[model samples]
Target: MAQRGFWIPLSLILVFASFVSLWWPGPNYGTDFRGGTEVEVVFTKAVEAHTVRQTVESLGYQTPDVVQVQDVKSPSHFIIRVQEVSSVTDATKEQLKKALCLTTDAAAAVADEHACPSNARATEVTFSPGGDKISTRYDSTPDLEKIKEQVRSVGGINLRAAADNPQIVNQRDNHVEIQLQSKGDQLMDGLRDKLGADTVPAQPLKVEWVGPKAGKQLRDSARNSVAIAIVFIMLYLAFRFDLRFAPGVVVASVHDAMVIIGVFVVLRKEITVSTIAAVLTIVGYSMNDTVVIYDRIRENLSKHRGKSFWDIINMSVSETLSRTILTAGVTMLSMLAFFVWGTGVIRDFALAVVIGIVAGTYSSIYVAAPLTEWIDKRMTQRLGAKKKRPSGKRRAKAVTGKPAEAK
Candidate 1:
């Protein structure tokens, strides 16, 4: 209790390290918030990450990250990330117009002149609100099959029309909407085309993409949610105990959060949607640990009213230390299984929780307890100073919050 100042330096060092590590190279955001494409695939045979990286990079994609998934069923499973793919670019749309003889380049370029004819092409090609559904409007219906084939070949085979086939909104006006499957098809096609010898892109694959606007919204919402949570927790603590205890809990929670985040930043792990979930979960978990300590201290304060404030904090923390360790250890061990076999996102969540448990335990003692003690010390000094002040008309007026009628 007397040597609390010595321990404060350690906490400062940790915060400094975490802050520097977090902001230096910055965080690498995942597809959920970074507006990118992610593809998960399984290779037929065991392959190294670098080998797969080369294969994917050869498909005109520059330096796409390839990571091997730790799945028991498929040892060769891998995930790939591409910043953007299957974009409905203006160039692709223009070529679609040309191939349909809507432009001058159509007649020579397209093979079936009779079936396609002239003056027969889509008037407009527009993407849906979500940008996955593509609608093409034409003055008259051209050949659907040829249009599908030409659209597939254009813009480096990026856009894929789903097998569900194009749905015609208007037969007379030739308004058709095509569902966009994924850039994965093109990715798989490229992989199979390039790696037919290797036979990768093996069985089932999954892909997901988030638009930039949508991703930003998610990121902003996640921050707001975390902040709102902390505010509520602070209010709960204040009402539950007092201002002395509430600040410590809030500070400890924030410290745990920053340190855990610093950990991911140091590891260069992407802060995915799952990671955010883990963070929120950790806040509640850490708060629970702090509350346990605070509860114990509050109980002891009543039992030992004569004891000094620091002595009470020290005794309370010492009494609860073993319980904290045992509880945190069990929780971490449970998460260990998830770390061992869970997929990427699950593993991320598990890893975060594990780190947070350790951090929460430490902060509850060193950071939270000490902060409360310091606040108590300051408050006591103010009280003692007020007691020494001259008890005259000025003090009387100040104390009563009204003027003294006579002195």
Candidate 2:
């Protein structure tokens, strides 16, 4: 017989580890679940993640979760995640105005000052009104192209020349308008200040915000879905097999889920909708594995009637071992590829699958089979005790020393 002495201890340890991991820091929920903003920024030139983090942090905001958006066509892209803000604050607007305003000599042409900010070369420094729309004025005809390029560095989008133009002698003729989108644009000015005016402009490719209520709804839905799935699995197993087999299958499935979730908790990976989907998928996968082994055990029961229950189980597992390995191996390889090369949610989903697959395989072999065998043994013992009990008529016949009539 295979020695299972270590199985109980190992299972206990794993359960304890999972408990601790979940109780301490807990699983790290992503923007999808926790309610936050996700911004995808595409720069004209490649920027390092550390530099981005440093720049974002310097702007009086928490460091965002940053990941490089890897693609052959768009190599200079990054995705940053932070808490959501409803609108830009007045203080942030003022900072942006100061950063965009350039102090240049009255005689300096707009084209000459476009390359870099000349603090020492400037004869006068002026700023537009600090409001939703900011406009800058200059004595000479400002290079609209250069001004637009500069505005872009500070998250200024939809740039246009203001309607007001002065052709009067010794008066400013250039006026430019800037429109700001979100609070994130406030960082643009800070970034320009740090990276210099010559740096390539950063453009917002996508922005996603999840409200707290919406996040709560999503979390509740994810929980309900998982619970419903487990219930359905238990019902299906009980209907398909003997009641004795259902407990083991359900326990194994739950064990697989907990272990997979525990891994994410330990790793501090974000739990997104994709993660929930992966977990549910793993439940089905694990149930399938357990069912296959259970089917084999059932088939062997009549064929190996004289064999001990333990022997039968062992033989069944041995017979199906190759199939189990092949199936899990192929699936694991595919998930591994996704984990290694995939990006964003796809990568996280693959990671969850990888963990679930290992846990499921282990539970199927060690957890489900042993549990079924134990339950079957307890049931047999109970039935045997009942059968060994003498009936009331039998007891009376023995006391009276007379044989009972045959039924």
Candidate 3:
């Protein structure tokens, strides 16, 4: 038989790494959920997140936040958020696109500087408010025709082009600001066709950006959430099984979470606020699978005391293999739909769920159940050999031997 103890050390290592990242994650969320520039656009028709993401990508930005933020009182809503980075020049183009798409009073808040002072060294182009005497930022001028083509496709108009001179702020930290023309709000209303129908409009003039305040809150909340979740799962497992089984399940859950987070870090996927929510959701999902497998293990142990530890564990996993596979398949199908059809905001959320489900399934069979059996065997050997307690009235039956009552 394979040595069951071998998996415990690996489980512990994975859990420790994941717990560290919960507090010290490197990526930051977008302003929409985290509070940055609120660019609200009302399209000529309904739009989808993928199209918006594509348009933004074409404009030379990374994926922006596209969420349905609504005012409880008003039927009207809008999609809000910032730009992504492609090439260096695209960043400036992104800012300009954001300025033109504005449909909120917040757009007017952008500075009219020729180019942002802080970004001067990095950005190849400059930004200025749309008009004459606009200060130029970059040495090389961008193709205005290309810019106009993409802008028009995404429902952008009002052509008064200038250099990509980005206005700089003295915030002493990293951030971008955008200002819309007086027609900004109306302009956004015209571009609503780019935002998908599933998106609900948000209140106008709301500022969205990732600042220190939102960042810290996001960090703390993610940390606290993970801690609380792990604690609760451990408690629940302990209550249902013995304390010995709890450690194994917790290890497996943490392993699943860690592998997902590590992959995200390596992939450099934007870890947004929604990403944290996704992590928490995945944790619960992973625990659910672990619990189901564990339940089977306890049942098998009761039914077959004469079986070897490896046999019992293998049996439990095999018995539930069909259920686990079906459940995982159905859950993944739903997540796949969200991922393929959903917008940028929740795409990460769905991706995280998919990763967690796969990892959870593997850990339940290979990690949790196996580890539980290993520990149980170790405990039984130690106690059964060490103590000479009789098969008497008081002691309950060990998994390996007959219970006192039965004897």
Please tell me which model should have the higher TM-score, number 2 or number 3: 2
Higher-lDDT candidate among 1 and 2? 1
Which pairs of residues clash in candidate 2, taking residues 3 or more apart in a chain or in different chains? 105-123
Give candidate 2 regions above 4 Å deviation. Answer: 45-50, 68-77, 88-180, 183-202, 390-407
Instruction: Per model, state how many residue pairs clash.
Output: 0, 1, 35
Predicted candidate 1 versus true structure: per-residue lDDT over 1-407, tens digit per residue? 66667867877887788888867878878878877678888888777888879988888786687878888898888889887645555676566555544544444535665645533465676765344566777655656676676566555533453564666877887778766546666677778787674766444478777777778998899888888888899999999999988989888888888878888998888898888888888899999999998999999999999999888999998999899889998998999999987888898889998898888888888899999988999999999999888577778788888877873
State the displacement of the C-alpha of residue 188, model 1, in Å, after optimal TM-score superposition.
1.5
Using TM-score as the yardstick, the better of models 1 and 2 is 1
lDDT winner, 1 or 3: 1
Query: Model 3, residue 321: what's the lDDT?
Result: 87
* Candidate 1 to native Cα RMSD, angstroms: 5.2
Which digits, one per residue and each the tens of the lDDT, describe model 3 over residues 1-407?
26446755666676676566546664444552343344655433445556655664454344555655333433243464553211113354655544333223333323532322222312322443221112222222333343343344433333333354223332343223323232323324434334443452432444333444555687777778888898899998899889878988787777887877765665556666677777788888888888887788789889999988788778877888899999999999999998877655677789888988888887887787777776887898888876876445544555436546553
The TM-score, computed over Cα atoms with residue i paired to residue i, of candidate 3 is 0.53
Error of 1 at 189 (Å): 1.4
